[model samples]
Target: MDSRSSDVSARQERGETGGWISTPVTTDLLRGALDLEHTEHGALPHRLPARARAQCSDGQLAMAEAQPSGVRLVLRTRATAVELDTLPTKVAYRGAPPGPDGVYDLLVDGHLVARTSVTGGNLRTVDMTTGSVETRTGPVGTARFSGLSAEPKELEIWLPHNEITQLVELRADAPVEAVPDRGRQVWLHHGSSISHGSDAASPTTTWPALAAFRGGVELINLGLGGSALLDPFTARALRDTPAELISVKLGINLVNADLMRLRAFTPAVHGFLDTVREGHPSTPLLVVSPIHCPIHEDTPGPSVPDFGDFEAGKLTFRAGGDPAERAAGKLTLNVIREELSRIVKQRAAEDPNLHHLDGRELYGEADTAELPLPDRLHPDAATHRRIGERFAERIFGTGGPFAARDD
Candidate 1:
């Protein structure tokens, strides 16, 4: 019997009625989750496992990993109604009011059918000036989707990309089972906020998600916003994860964060690649630099929020570091690009599978002229689509770096 038939047969054997079945959430039912941790409320999906998380204590890293950028729950059922109870962590800036409620995207049989948001969750307040933070308890909320076709079909509930989700419970009118794997290659990617869907319209519209959709592959995104420095723990996480294709978008984070000097950056990049190669020596790996950020292209950073329209909830960024510091080994987009090219070319002879793509190729000078970044930092929704489509065409297209090996 087929898997769907077996599901029915098992339900009958259990003397079950045509009522709701509360299936336990297991790792098998989760995608885009590198790890799952039990919290006071429920299961918390983490892109980085505990071992790797233990190595870093940065609050930004902690929050970003918990945001569930690409994580989703997948199942197969004939249920007409499904409800998911979750506690989402909502963010609030000290001076600026809270943004819109985070959204949950639902797909049935590979087609987006609905978008919904839960009512209540935890709240975290941040004082960007003082760096003071506070957390408060909140009620749990439910996301209900009814009137689904009662035919055995695959269902995907994408968690909120901008908030940390604590999954409390899941209930469906019919038995639900893990979605059967379709043998799609997994593409593991690591980058900064742009890859984290900060300015992107929705979770599925994130450039990485878009590229994965067009490339016909599953994605594991480690796109930590404001926290994509080449941390050893992050490199270790990338080393351990299994992926057919991998890409690391470097430079912008290092530049904007102003975290390292050129002297330290070269060795850091080399060390990161070395660790990843230890685990997957022959896997196709691509190194991508930052996309066009006019503010930090030639300028150095440690970019600061403009806060010009704080009353209106508008936060934009401006490069703060002096360009003259570049002469003293300070990092800039231009400098990093030159160094990344040299490093990749030097290593390619020994590691033929390694390739480098200047991030500008994805959203370069010309495109920036037409569609500029709203905050002078991250790309907006339209630019996200442009980058995603360009990435799909350049990397996954014929003879591209991510082209299927069989093809």
Candidate 2:
């Protein structure tokens, strides 16, 4: 008999209804999110907790944290089919056509089995030039997956990394339960848009997600897009999060936003690390500098969006700050990298578990020629894969900082 029929038979034998079973979308079923807010319609995952979110008034940070970069629903069930009802808030440029819908990736027992996207939720239109946003509400939609084996198996529904998703409901033909701990070390990572899965093919393919899978570790990605500005609250969030390994990818956002000068940037970095160390005193913490972005390498930012191709639905970014400003202590990618290296080396002297990884090693000048960033900022999907593979080899391989210990 087919899996559906078997489910019906099993339900009949147990004197229960054969209709779909509803499961609550609670913290037990969620991975990667630091907090879950009970919304009017459903549960919305946030990378930062309520306290941290309350501390920040920036809308970019609000949206980024709610986008759910590496978040997923993890469960074990014998059901042949599953359904998730979500209210996704998609972003759109003012004049440019809306980009493709965010992707939902379904993994069965650690292998990607299906991918899908939801339609008809909410739309957030942004006037990039003016930095103003408008919102329109739409109906919630369901993402369905079917044709699975009847035997019990673990299932992971990776939410869209670029859309703010409020999980409405979960349904399955058979009973579902939270998957028990697999004893994998949890790796917590923080970074900007690239690590937030910008332009990534899907949620699971984000560099951090890919690296986590390859390294056989659970991931709690705090990649808050343009909001990775060394916020003290974000540091506290990372500090309190339980993890065996930690990594912070810094620089790009700070440069692009022109949020601080070298003087402020240096102390902010130290304070962020100090806060995290307070909680995770001895965790294997890796400090990674910014990756290669030619425009911001030597030139400073506030990087502005180039809408020259707006009519054609293309958007790119260019550095707007004067290179000469670097002499006045305006931060640049090169400066950030040097400072980060110095900081890590200085700290590692007293903290044995502290480590440093040059971001260019993952995607450097050489790789740029072959796989140029599509938007002159974020790496393309192929680049994400390459970076993910390189990170796995460098950080989790033999003699690497996060390598498994014999003990």
Candidate 3:
């Protein structure tokens, strides 16, 4: 057996601490999860439940959501040292350089204290030229952290936000238990890559996580990178999940993917909202348009990647659709904003909790000049913080849509 496999076996057999419990990483200890699927390696947390996943066979959607962007494991224990055995799935582009190593973040009593990476895991390779995919299996590895205070603490181990992970086991020097729910309001958010944290420094820095931290809410992030196409299954997933407040950031993905025209877009928005309302008739729901993306603001899209610095390992994107396409009913950021506002206003008469917030209000022309998107597509770490802070202030502060109801 390999050395890593031998070590795991030894720990399982020894029961090392005389009392250190070896906890099976079950769904009960997982937060920000909508579903848990058992795999040969271990338990895989899925952001979308089984019913939703079964309704569609889109491999892109399956992979994007299963990456566990905002998921974390919550445990209450007094252990000073913690070790987690995981089989992470890392992606590799065929022609481009290797992707960055995935990061695991540990938070003690809700404060980030350490960041680490495992040496080995699974690998998935994608060949852009042939449009083919392959995955190679690898042994599980461990991430260890120590020097924490001995006092009982609420510890959270955030899984890699961008990697597909299957949690194998969790071991600590002291016994651990699932953290009890703290009665925080749940915020369910759906968006594209920006909300999924494309260029954020770490998992915890993702805009959704940051906003959840500042707004004092538990986050259920359904930010599917490049797959936020307002699919019926996604709407159904949101409908079934319980939430006090919810928001959907739309536009960029649709335009960039060149998925649909203006004619098909209108009814799709109404239909998506209709599905959610069936389950949550009165929950506050907000519709946010695309933030300021200079390329897609006026021009249409089918964005193409720019490899000008490929040899230097730098990649960016540029819009390919022409500005004249708007006359032919093509979708654009401005067109999306107007349609979303009109739809919300027309529906607000009956749905009292429905609201609309222009994406520009969150990040507009003024902010773009100062905090430009690094890839010409996704915002950088600094911009993410600014957006998250702005979201907290505008959505959860006094007079905000999510402010506590006095009644």
Candidate 4:
């Protein structure tokens, strides 16, 4: 070998390396269809969830299906645990279901850190009985396991391991530096299907994720597909999560779910903000209404041609958004606009940090004229990009967010 190569080898031999190695440990990176099956009373009942859970929500299994096509195994005694294995600094186990109903108490070194609702919310679209690698939970969020002890904490899944259930999409993420050095003013966001990237091209391509990348900030995305009904637990989650900036995208999901009406929405929003402000007394909080969706923009309640299509006339709203739901109050875009503004304003008097962003501003009825959500409920990739750009410019501004990377 040349002297340069020899010298490089010598340095490597001398243990002077702090960068990626030419050869990555490919044994773990092998690609395959990973599916986590579910079990009833100790037997396979359905397929596993298809979407990924949140980052801090990563879980492992006592058993799992190997990378090779359909091969499965019981990892109890055979599997090796990484003793004090290095985990991502920014990540932590938020909620692990320890008992039945697929729920686990979350602990960071024996301290009950966070508790999550059981598989209770994922039943609509997720298959708890089948074996599939599904993203069943919300989007990314902010957190730090700054002082995690080297104790092995047990995590329980909703599935029965003794039977046919096995964990798939076994991911252990190591957080990457999207921004070099910054103040770390985190962003907390809660939204609906668009926010959840129901049909957005990729995970990273989601508007919230993209906006986070551009803003040079960490994000906690709680964008559920159809679950953004302003739940109390969700609001509590937001209230508990630490963030310098926060935003809640309301509308579309509410309109589609036909869950509530104007009256309840107003108070629920008030209570949601009230709880959030309890945690972040002066954090910059923004409440965003729905973006432009013509059918639902003018009307209330969302319906689709199918579970996924919206452009066709076959797609229409359910007879003026349920009467009981409406009796809760007619929650149209106009109502959401009026109420969201009023709610944020009420919160702002006590906390000057509160703010509001009309979703129509991001993508209004006019914008929808040119660009509409493909399936009536979810936006396409282009819509995501557009929203991200707008969000960056509006909320983040040219200052490149309140927190930015150091040169």
Candidate 5:
């Protein structure tokens, strides 16, 4: 869709509709397109593979929760039929995500073909890397899907890394009428599940999506569930994208991974932003801390939900360090919080354009008392709404970080 069209669409959503075509998707017209729309019902979880749990592949460790909408009409080219050695000119629907954990259900012309979680979002565009491999797509993994033709294909997927009880009505290629192009900004956000809508009722309700709606920008959510580990490649991707407003929600992932001490984390963050600056230079950048998590409330410790509890059909986060271990480990939320405060202050001092917000400000100990994660690691849909509202209040508006000058 064109920017002119998107702006007009945004206006319509905002009740400022005019000068744009507002067309809803119809089943007939939708048949012509290849796409998937997230089920409008509720959140779904990705059932990770056993290998993922055992090997801890980065791809497995940094799980991205998403859902497949479904695949539509397949247009086969002569060359594609021979490449994969599948049925000549048959529609192929398969998923092959890295590390082979989650599964995506595939449908051909609304017919269920197969279900596997090893697939990832098709790369509509290529992202850059820190070391400079300029490909126009994400890494390709071996697909486990079978028998379907490898012709022109469209597949929809549900991308959660656990369960699907929350998944609502599954939607396939619904006719998406887009307005013509108009110049507009695209906002790119990177963070934990909060940014990924871990609790938001739907795909669009996530805070980044909400904020994008409020500000009128295109959203490219690079929210990986456990994936936002402050990788340099991720920062490189951010720097390389053409984003109007950029933010990196930092605290929770670092805390959860327990990857670094204060010594390593502080410098790593600075370096990440510095690399982003090399590309964005002056784009407004916001660094968000983690929202409330009681496990790390007072003291930081190994924060992971108990799998045994999950397997027993219970969802709970048992701080790896119990009271006795916490005392001995010298790990506590206070340590992490103090370090985060320092990181932000130092970064702000160095770069006027850089901004930071401690996650607690969004959901603090008090708020945690009222609202807690199901697994004590991720927030729920309601919490997501609250977080988005708070973020809009602070980051939107003319003098806010989102509203800051690019220069």
Candidate 6:
């Protein structure tokens, strides 16, 4: 066994409370979650509230929201060592090799300090071809971080972005208290899987998370994978949430799901913005069109997974609809971008705070040559960083829509 494993084993043998104090997991200690549901084992964070969740029955949305993409525990403590108990539900494709364990990132005073992963948690097996699933319960595991500065400082434990994790217990060598608000602007963003951090290296490195850090804002991410379908409940959730800055990344998911045609798409975008305006009329709201995606640039979608490399443990996506369908009002990336730009222009005439950004500005044709999306859907880790940096410069720098103001 490695030294860390041996130390963890020794701690287990000595008892979990060996000079450790337990801190209750409460709302004040959590950031980026809209709701917290008490579970049999622990507290499960939700990006959407109970009412919103009840309105939608899409399994994909349920899983995506529960994954806690940008959720983290924030506390003020002087502990040199800390431990978090979690019950993580990990997904696995039946025909492919098991994925690596979910990662937990430890940050001290806003800098990454340690990264670890748990083992022996619940397993969710998925049959992609059949659209079936099976789940097996397993034991809870602990994520431990040791050898810290021991000086009074803020600490953040970022949950895995792609796994459903239940926050069970927090043990530390020092007393932990809620971190006081730093008076940063709150940014609430909603989008599809790309914004959901599908292939991000870790929780804190997701595009949204990275942008939040760069912009010096507290984030409330509603980037639900496979479910940014401009649902009413999502709009309502955004309306109710308090935020100084807001953005909605649209189009890719709509096309991929073939969820709507042009007739419904325009009004849907307007309706979504209208609902948000009800609660945040003057807030800086940026509407971003789909990012550069050649597969669905001109072709209509219902993107389908390509399983030709299933045996090789690889999977990619391809647009399944024909380009000719555009004549039938079928939506594509280009079409959606045009409509979104037009809608924003019309609305901005009445609402000065409303702004539109072409997603290609964040990732365009040139980026594809250097950082091609591995799945032709989600950006890789490097691309996530690139998008985050570009977003920060475009939206939070100088006279951008979300630029800082002194009143």
Best by lDDT: 2
In model 4, which runs have C-alpha deviations exceeding 4 angstroms?
Answer: 1-183, 302-328, 399-407
TM for candidate 3 is: 0.95
Candidate rank order under TM-score: 6, 2, 3, 1, 5, 4
Quote the positional error of residue 151 for candidate 3 in Å. 1.0
TM-score of each: 0.94, 0.95, 0.95, 0.55, 0.58, 0.97
Indicate the TM-score of model 2.
0.95
The superposed Cα distance between candidate 1 and the true structure at residue 204, in angstroms, equals 0.7
Per-residue error (Å), model 2, residue 100: 1.2
Name model 1 segments beyond 4 Å from true.
Answer: 1-18
- Could you give candidate 2's per-residue lDDT for residues 300-343 as a string of tens digits? 99999998888799899999999999999999999999999999
Residues 314-346 of candidate 1: C-alpha lDDT, one tens digit per residue:
778899999999999999999999999999999
Better TM-score candidate (1, 4): 1
lDDT of 6 by residue, 1-407 (tens): 74335546878887753778988899999999999999988899999999999998888889999999999999999998898888899999888888789889988999998999989779999898998989999877889998898799999999999999998889899999998888999999999999999889999899999999999999999999999999999999999999999999999999999999999999999999999999999999999999999999999999998998876787789999999999999999999999999999999999999999999999999999999999899999999999999999999999898889889
Instruction: Return the candidate ranking by lDDT, descending.
Output: 2, 6, 1, 3, 5, 4
- Backbone clashes for every candidate come to 0, 0, 0, 29, 45, 0
Q: Write the per-residue lDDT of candidate 3 for residues 191-248, one digit (tens) a residue.
A: 9988888888888999889989998999999999888898999999999999999999
lDDT of 5 by residue, 264-301 (tens): 77778788888888888777888877776777765555
Name the top TM-score candidate: 6
- Evaluate model 1: give its lDDT: 0.90
